[model samples]
Target: MGLFDGYNIASSGMGAQRTRINIVSANIANAKTTHTEAGGPYKKQNVVFEELLVNNTKNLNNNLQETNNKNTSAELRGVGVKSIVENDADPIMKYEPSHPDANEEGYVAYPNINPVVEMVDLIEAMRSYEANVATFNTHKNIDSKTLEILKA
Candidate 1:
């Protein structure tokens, strides 16, 4: 693969993980939320990512067979977030008699989010982001060194 392919791949990973971290932060921030503009408690959100590999193997094979193909190269097409989906699981309801939003049964609905799990997810996303950044930096340094060697 060309030098920039590394950058492209790493950038895509960084973007995806950044989005994941943002969602995790939002989920954690709203863990105790009992009321939302949507009419009930907050729902936890998660990020989804899709790979961008070439879907047509035949095209790749044909390209490989072409003669004098100096332009042919492998590339990472980058990643895309599929969606920010809400969890369908039921919210946790507690018996809070004095709570303002309590129902006739003295049950107050809260978000289904687990703060500890969200925090763990946040830590994972942060680590993944850092790893991607490090990978990009390494590729950059390698590119720079290669350029310097070429100049020499």
Candidate 2:
């Protein structure tokens, strides 16, 4: 690990959580959308998070000493958004005979998204983002104090 690796790790988490928040917001915004340019209702989107691993020569050797450790030798590097995917579940079907997008059977296809669920996801994402920010700030404070102590 480098001297500033902690900052990078924390910032990566923040970025990933921000992307998650954006995806949740989009899902909520299109919750009631009954039609889209894709020829149907908008599909709810989700963010997939991935863990980044770093191979630090020294760290790897140290971690390898713990033979019983489950993680082996890979060091946790950062967080990343692996992908954003649309929900494959069937669309919500509603009987709306008068609606323009209604099927011949008088049922309209609404995006299979619930506002309450989206709101909860949004809150979770926001909280995660806040936690990352706190980590980053703590790193900054530690670095600042280290510099102050060094100057003395």
Candidate 3:
């Protein structure tokens, strides 16, 4: 890894966490929504994260040669959002005869979203984002110190 590699990794994590936060917020906002453009209740959305891999053959080869180790092929570059998918779980059906979106059986299909769970997920994402920011700031400070020493 390089000196700036930490920044890239942390920033990617921040981006992924931000995406998660947004998705959670959206799910929370649409928790009570009964009608959507898709013709049903709003579905809870989830952010999927994946490993961000960079093809740095030069770096990989150099490290392998230096260490005389050939077991590892690549390095974990960073994190990224793989996709945003709707919750596959069935919606909660509540008996609300007076509700406009209620079915003929007087059951309304509410989104499969739990407010408490969404709030917890939101807090987790926020904490993860904050941690990534701290990591980025630490890397920045270290780089600044290194440059100052080099100048001297």
Task: State each model's C-alpha RMSD to the native.
Answer: 5.7, 4.6, 4.8
> Regarding TM-score, does 1 or 3 come out ahead?
3
Worst 10 residues of 1 by lDDT: 53-62
Candidate 1 segments whose C-alpha is farther than 4 A from its true place: 53-77
lDDT for position 75 in model 3: 66
lDDT scores in order: 0.82, 0.85, 0.86
- Please write out the lDDT profile of model 2 over residues 11-54, one tens digit for every residue: 88999999999899999988899989879999999998866643
Among all windows of ten consecutive residues in candidate 3, which has the lowest summed lDDT?
53-62
Relative to the unseen true structure, what is the C-alpha lDDT of residue 15 in candidate 2, on a scale of 0 to 100? 92
Sorted on lDDT, highest at the top, how do the candidates line up?
Answer: 3, 2, 1
Per-residue lDDT value at 57 in model 3 = 31
Q: On residues 97-137, what C-alpha lDDT tens digit does candidate 3 reach at each position?
A: 99999999999999999999999999999999999999999
In model 3, where do residues sit more than 4 Å from their true spots?
54-73
